[model samples]
Target: MNLTPADTEVTGKPASRAKRPAKSAPGAATSAANAAPTTTPPVTSSPLATPTLTAGVASVTHLTEKLAEYMSPSDLKKVKEAYRFSDEMHLGQVRKSGEPYISHPIAVAEICSDWKLDAQAIMAALLHDVMEDQDVKKDELIERFGAPVAHLVDGLSKLEKIEFQSQIEAQAENFRKMLLAMASDVRVILIKLADRLHNMRTLDVMAPAKKRRIASETMEVYVPIAHRLGLNNIYRELQDLSFAHLYPLRYHVLAKAVKAARGNRREVVKKILEAVKNTLAMAEIDAEVYGREKTLYGIYKKMRSKHLTFSQVLDVYGFRVVVDSFPNCYVALGTLHSLYKPMPGKFKDYIAIRKLNGYQSLHTTLIGPYGTPVEFQIRTQEMHRTAESGVAAHWLYKTGDTNMSDLQQRTHSWLQSLLDIQQQTGDSAEFLEHVKVDLYPDSVYVFTPKSKIISLPRGATPIDFAYAIHTGIGDHTVSVTINGEAAQLRSELRNGDIVEIVTDPASRPSPSWLSFVRTGKARSAIRHHLRTINLPESIVLGRQLLTQALAAAHLEPDLPETLIERLLNESSAKSLDELYADIGIGKRMAALVARHIYGLMGGESAAMPVDHANAAELDPVTICGSEGVSVQLAQCCLPIPGDQIIGQLRRDQGLLVHTLDCTVAKRQKQKEPDRWIPVKWGSDINRRFDSRIKLLINNEKGILARVAAEIGESDANIVFVGMDEDAEHVLHQLRFTIQVKDRVHLAGLLRNVRRVAGVNRVLRERS
Candidate 1:
């Protein structure tokens, strides 16, 4: 955002536009990508002069006077109408700082004007809060200002009328709404950013908690967005402001340090700036050179992350060299490099490969006049504008400017991705999570086999790369070859590594992939696919469990559909599918659900309320570890067919299956007995269960063969094998996971193994 109308509220969108996020797929040509848009804070105070207008007050007052540079006469008149309408709607309202609420909108409008936004955007900024704070209708605005302007205001308004489960859900929902609007007409985001900038600047009057919360949110979400949008000036100010609000002491201390550094190094900075200018002038390069200080927040981040003190954070000063044309940018860089040695590996040609945010510059750290490192950013004036304003630069430079095309495309692609992620993850919270993952500022630019630059977060892996290319490839990936070398699926991608994901139709995404995948999209896609693939099987299992529980409640199979609906409603589930899915996943005890349904049906003693808090009274479910996301087969117990089993509901992890005699289960039961659910083997246990046993075998050549043959003879396959080696021992200690029917089959296998020619003794292992 830009400078405030007074000093109270800072306004103006960043001058730069983030790179247009384009689809990066193998065989697709190069491009750039990246953030979101906001809300009305409590009425705020600012030093700007307010237009005094009373209710029913007619004004031949202001129109285009402030925006004369950007607005036409006709558009200015219409903007006046919008201002009049909005002012009246918020007539008696006052902000937290005791400012007339009307003054707030005008201040926001001023910020938009500074961005050189169109009259429609300026007018929308004036009325953005009216719809939410007052009873103004969308249709009424359309009638007065035309659909385009109405739409912009509507996009900026928070959906306060809609109920949200949490504050975060509400915030995310608002962003979703705003992004959708901004995607269609980028002006909406510009106006929203202006509003945020104004509010943040005048945030001094708010309560400590609210101030901290807003400031933290601004730092985490908005500041980066400003950076991504290339609103460097606003981005920097917002970052400093948010830092000041969130950590007042740190902000003041850091501010002083930067100030002191500037004073101490003023001579060095002046020397560097003059020397660079002289060199460029010597080379006959037309450029403007000036010294620039790094933002306070950036310096603080470096200090904290790199464990550096104030004085140790070198490169705190830099120079911006803005040239008239693109070619002169290169010429200026050459001239500067000739004057001072460029720091090895401290050079980047963003001009050749723009940042994901569409930032283009020739960045090089140099040995400056004082022998201390100084950063130099060389770019054309146009690039400089986009670098500062980011997405907002699109309006400043115009759509037809070739420099803005990459940014526009990147913005469009990123917006489309938000829509796609929203569609993929129906829940606002989850979508926000995915949004957070993609919002990480640091990204590694990797190349696909076909040389397409696929960008991912710094710690992204092959799975993230594969998914970034296509979900199908990530899901079915069988192998990966990075830079002509075969690598693990979890290999971290490095900058410039050529990654080729080898996928197979026969392969499937493993549950383990959830642990290593770094990208939110990949995580969501995997989770969604797992949910999609598992829900049907889960539902089937859930239905079977319910049927058994209903029978226990003395209910018949031909029960009325109305009763099922009632049960679903009682469970607070949207559908029977959801209800079953819940039960299948182990969220609700089948027996407990049955009891509730029975009580609803007025069964004998059903008149008595069921106390689910004492769920231990409920009959346990039949053990089948197939319930997706709900039930997990305990790795410790490794219960197979015929094992005495029990189920326990663990928070967030679903239902866990354990052997009745498992020491882990016993310990848990002793600690939280209410969680224990009775479980037994099902009638048709068709699936294989892995049962492990330890054996003491004579160290004979054919002992391994004998043990394997004996297990095969018992009709149980050896799923795994391990041996504990001891040089002094003549007997080999072996462990095996064998598939079996149940305890009965496992007991039979144990006997068969004990009778093996070289096997001396065998015992069942305890979990």
Candidate 2:
């Protein structure tokens, strides 16, 4: 019987694939591929009677033969069995390119075999689509193949059953699932990459829009993943293929230009190759030197990022020297430098400090004949293998080599980080965002106090460094120092800086840290900590707000369980604390909540008249400046103790205390008067508050020093200092943010600063 058209509608599969009937019951033999043959059946009389079918069978036979080289006979037999099951499940399905559906999985399997993966991984690759397209359950695969293969196949499958709110959410959730699975078994991602690579190789049949979308995903996600895993070959190929589909015109133009450039630069390349080979020979170094050209996508990226034209993109032609030993790598680099004039500041020794992905090479740029810039990379043979295959080198070599073990460890560390981020992030979309942030390839290497090297993304701050060291240290970081000098927590780290993080038992993550942290682990940890603490803090503030509102209405702070339950029911809150949190976070106004409670208490609302008395008459919520995130002093006014302050209940932000006359608080009061509440300084305030004072001084050196000395003499610590020049007046306007105990302390400090010589004027600056 001919295959029907009902089974070819999968998302990534080609549309022209001939469909088959609906999937049969589990464990049932459906096609001649799966049926037990009593004897050798004639090809023409069998179900595979077409020419394409004969070719497909021959391809499988060839694949089985190839597997025998690396796999045991029993393992090879199992692989053949998996192919048969896959063929039966995909019976009569053909691709848009007119290839049988089974060809896709077989191709994926072949790719994995090239990596010399174990038989289970190869089997999972062969049967990857059966569970995805044919409704073959994971348990059924387990019953047939085993749990390991089943798990890999299941990890490869997408979340088709559960629905998502949007396509983006669905895609993000799918990525999250796959990444988590990869953390459990790195083989899953390896096989998944193989599947994607094969699909990308055959993506021509897809529509333009689908091509662009898939290509964009491959570039944005898979390419970086490949690079991160040290799969240089796959990484480069995926980048080029994605570029071809995403920007076809540019890809073609660049490809043609590169082809022409190659011919034109052939003589230069030949000269460099000969010179390098001669130099190595004279040095008695046994090294293999080969010429190489930059990938089209790499060239394109360089051009766009550096704003350079194709002609200006020098160093596109390069050479790789594979040495016999690691030490010879440096010897080769020195030999190349001697043969050509080395470009200034164009040498890097990745051999001394390996990349986060375990890539090691010594790179140098030199001025060649006719002023052409040529690049060169030198590495050992084993390093070359790892550079090309990355984590796959662990399996490809499989000799328990130290380098391979190190590569595997690095890959697993990155995978473990993915799990850590996933645990802290609750939303699939947010988890994807954090992971993408971590995937950036640009990195800066820093050192710890103990001289331990730590790699972080460029623009990473000390907070990111702390988090990279350990989550607990990040959570409790109170101060930091760079190169033995105290530094700001938000300061961007540079290469080779010795970062030291000091922690306190009471120190906790600050919400402001979220603005500067560059690592996913730091961001996720901060967000998770905030989420964990916010609810309870909100409930406490909500209780205080509701109690204040209740006091205004002549009611007791405590209510009976029945009354509280009624309020919870009426507000649709899960509990009293939830209702309190809602009110505290301004999700529900405390006044309205109190009014509802009054009604429940059988009080006459008409008689209450909503207490519009003077705020001075009502009891105020006290602030000690250590109320955690539930209470924050407004930065605009920097309200200290003894200032007339008012609290604004902000949605999801708890209570923000501001000076009564602060411009921001005045504006917010006019807009949402109901959210404003009375607040006052506590009787026993113990911490310092930040206050800013501006000084206009003569433009003389040492003027800043005199002012700083005065502030120090007054026992006021300057937290930050900013300066601007007033050319017209020949003066420097210096603004200092200092910490003081209260308004009284700040006034005294201002007096002391006014006595400094060269000081023109000093005033407390307020927004």
Candidate 3:
């Protein structure tokens, strides 16, 4: 807890240690008194006193009393067993604050109880750290508690014991494990979130640097994950606590500003509540209304992000109106909107289109009598309960309600997509990359031709939706229909729009699609499908051709696959399966793989040259001439229409393309540039290429988003966006490396970029 003035005096510590630096003169000649040096101590000179072992027993008793209100007799007995086990395991352990470690587990358990989670989660919370901190074994936990409870404990335990290269990596890996468990059993993440919240609340006891790192990691990883999982109560509290420690100055200032604003707007809030109550009552909509305060973190975020002052923050106060049913929620929205003039475009109907996290509400920002914008959220009593407790509401509303037929049908789509993503992504880092991109909350709900609604992230194009529905649909999608009219597949979908996909069965998956698709599931599926259909052919043909080509240099294709697998695995390819898949789609250089394979197998076939005479026999081609034979820029690397190039003839890799100046190519050339032959774009060559370019512009309001929309309008596809590097002066650079038809199309796109409102300049990159 942060100290108050009275608390500071009672604790016998200064408000800030820096205020009394213990030294008088800076450079004065030293006498006996002046010669005494000074030291800077911590702000908190002492820790909170430890709870006694007797108090530990009383605390468990207190917890048992709390549990009595929520658990059954059998569950209560299980809880007692867990408490006893944790208390015994942590018998001699103590926290840095000198408190019995048992207190930590008790506190964590109390937090889980607040979420009203299951008995297993509560028990797991009480023993989360026992396996890591003590010598307790998993078998002991399983024997004492049930296997389910033990699994939760083990999942939590790994997060503490695992060593990672960096704190961020460790947090990411832990979060990944927690999410995987949540996917199988939702309670694990719920318990983990509770543990994180309690940790953040008491983070002040640690050193300042450690506090900042912990707070930052919590804010970036756990809070977002919790929000994604719909744990709103924990999400809000964690975000606020992290903000308090991560940016103490900003937190205090924002808190003071919000407090002052609330003091001034108390009458306004009261009047609005009265007006809303009267309006609802007249409509015969029975409801319970409560005021809402903007968290300090929310305010601080707005001030720094929107560049607004406290006075300019309009939606600082609001109301959460809970009614009896979904119909009554709409009734209340109608009544409220009728009484107040809603700010233009400030209404959001999340009730019909709930967020990915299962959040549902009808939100509107209205201008009151004084022109101040006050936001109001209307929901059913069920939604209110779920809004506060989130996934835990599954237990609260129906304890034994395992028949989640409705929810399963709705949620299974996303869950199955996760499995698909994991399958397609060869490694954890790539999976995480794709998952983080999808976790962002800006989403739109569009409908299928059959009128089924699908929620996708905002800026998600019809192509993304197509892939979301089915990989085959996306792979073969030629066009789309939006509300019964022909629409481009790249067109952004909006709420309530009906969409239909037009596909061609003969069409193949384009490597360029990876740039546009948003969800991890879609990307994974596309890659998986492409590999399954194409890798075997490429590998067989590549091996045959490479075997013959390597024979010219006295090498064999009979080498063990282990050497090649080890090399590629480090780059995230699992086996020859992934390597061949990438080679088949022009995503990976076959020669690079082959050369590495040969090197590992102790062969000196690095000098083999492309066989122009047999190039056509090995792979079908549109161009064949002695000048360059059928060289094409690898769409994966987008070796531009006018650039130096090299050809690596793989065993089965038809022809691998690379920039002559590519580092990989340079290294290969050092050994053998004869293996790297010159190639050029054919005159009639027509294909899309991803030529990336960076633009630095003043960070004007809505500039970056507007630029993205403009690129979308140009029929060009932006593959990714690096986060803004700086936020101070609207001076942020966006690196938009997108796919365009050819050199002419790329030129046109660059010209369009130059015309964007905030774009300072645009240039085609040389590197």
Top of the candidates by lDDT: 2
Q: What is the lDDT of candidate 2?
A: 0.80
Instruction: Summarize candidate 1's per-residue lDDT along 30-61 as a digit string, tens digits.
Output: 11100111222212221121122232222223
Candidate 3 lDDT, tens digit per residue, 1-767? 11111111111222332121233342221222122222111111011111112212214655676789979999998887777666665554445454455666776787677766678888998888777656477897788787888888876755655544355555456556655666666677677776666566556666787677677767766777677766676777777888888888987777777768878989988998898888889999889998988777777788889999888888887789999888888778878889998888988887777877778899988888688888889998877766776666664222245676343333444545656677676445556666776767678889998988888888788888888788778889888889999987667788788999889989766545665777777677666664566556555534444454444334565656676666665545666555554554444454565665655666553754545565434432222222121123454455755555566643222355776667766666687543443345556655556777788787678888888988898898888676465756547777877877666777887888899888987776544
Better of 1 and 3 by TM-score: 1
Quote the RMSD, in angstroms, for model 2: 9.2
TM-score of each: 0.76, 0.75, 0.68
RMSD of each: 10.6, 9.2, 15.1
Better of 1 and 3 by lDDT: 1
Pairs of residues clashing in candidate 2: 4-19, 17-94
Better of 2 and 3 by TM-score: 2
Off by over 4 Å in 1: 1-63, 164-168, 327-331, 395-404, 505-509, 540-574, 582-614, 625-767
Worst 10 residues of 2 by lDDT: 41-50
> How far out, in Å, is residue 120 in model 1?
2.0
What TM-score does structure 2 among the candidates reach? Answer: 0.75
Ranking by TM-score: 1, 2, 3
